[model samples]
Target: MSSAHELTQEQSDRYWQDGFLFPLSVFSEDEAAEFRAELEQVEKDWLAADLPLPLNTYKRVNAHLVIPLAARIAQDKRILDTVEGVLGPDIMIWSAEFFIKEPQTKQTVGMHQDLTYWGMGETPDQVTAWIALSPATVQSGCMDFVRGSHKNPILPHTDTYSETNLLSRGQEVAVDVSEDDKTHIELKPGQMSLHHGLTIHGSGPNASNDRRIGLAIRYLSPGAQQLVADRDYAMLARGSDAHSNFVPVQAPDALFSPEALALYEQVRLDQSKALAEGADSAVPLYTKM
Candidate 1:
């Protein structure tokens, strides 16, 4: 894999200006196809299960085991190089999520910074690599971002659905922003978009006939700390001693090889220690609007 040290000056500058960047063909078509097959198998297994689904089933419904195909892509030299360039040498696979937009599904995500969900401190170092496992188009609810929103103050967020919608989990309503200022991100299979953790973004509902699936891999800088007292979400340290609270999911080993695993284990241990020390001093990063 190429080292993060090799990013061109232009690539680095673009990321700083745009708050997001799309790198073409990060994965080969063949590699994407294999991962899609694995995802399908997982979905089938979930459907055949007899137990009642969890309350957070929509978020936890997808299986996250690092299939061999995905593992290979996660370790791709080019990806590692770019991510390292943005986040620095020491990093951890913070989390991975499968965003599956079913056809005709009217579930739109509200415009908000990722840190709003993560509950981490405001720092420009964190990065998220969102890979398109299938063709992602505007019709299929492709992602949208406020071009320079990363430079703006973090906005309040709310649930994407209305009170009438069945999936409402009482998520905060997103702050209003102008549509004219947003940029749509459309990608073909194998392409990926990398964004800052504080970038203001969201997606529309899938109105197309096919499913729009994206695998988002989140990365944290080496020194990022975790807040343990916060029960609603996991927070990563970035600025001062404050952290942002985001939903914490189990780390998947498939995404990390032996070398990555070693780094992840060390970070996990350190995070545990920090949580233990600050067990009684957790604070909210934002207030309700």
Candidate 2:
């Protein structure tokens, strides 16, 4: 629970230049353990379902119930201070998604920038922080980024799901990079990596006999406008002057303190409202058609 004021200038430069930077041990073991337990509970709930696509599965993948834990981590002074140092104090949590690679599930997240999904105007201030909840290694499908790829123009690629069961889709298009220029990010639990939204990066498959779970949170500067068409999920700020385009899913009261559990309830309500209103109308930047 350290303050978020420790982001150094070197780290900022590294992120800006390379499009990604890894900070080791950002979350303490206790915090990681708490999240692990919460995820286990979520998994249990998912396993009890008989549907082809369990409701919890989709929710977990889309970062529904995980808001409580993510909010806790995002609000930690240490992380928040760093975010402020980089993006500023007026900020909004853009989007959160879980990349879970189960044992023997060979899925490679194709190389692409996160901004492509949001269809927003480009800005260097937008970044996505992927927090490793489990050990991420080459054998367990760690993420790999193209060195200096963020400096290049955005390239087009076929957008599809990461896997077709247990192997990659086996489709590759030529990009202006070599194998020698790629950097594999091997992270242990509690470690995290920050990357520019336009960074060209992808992950390997889980060849090992374990699951690889990572939580990704996207943050935007306070003034960054929401270019995405749908606005149902967008919550208008009621009290704060934070004119952010990204909506706050976790309740303000539960953002910190004794009644944190109540935040999840609010998130559930918000999610339900978004669903009833059909909020996934954001235009995709790329399509395979």
lDDT by residue (tens digit), candidate 1, 36-98: 887777566545554233212323212232233433445566666767768766544555567
lDDT per residue as tens, model 2, 1-289? 4454556788777878898888645787667767877867756755665533344333343343233555556555555566655676555565556678887875777666555545455666577778888889989989888878888664654423234422122223236556677799999888888888778887778988878888887776656664544431332212243554554555334212334334433443443432222223321111111
Model 2 collision count: 5
The best candidate by TM-score is 2
Clashes of 1: 19
- In model 2, the runs with Cα more than 4 Å from the true position are 1-5, 49-53, 56-67, 165-177, 230-249, 252-289
Worst lDDT run of 10 residues, candidate 2, spans 280-289
Each candidate's lDDT (Cα)? 0.59, 0.59
Q: Residue 133 deviation, candidate 2, in Å? A: 0.9
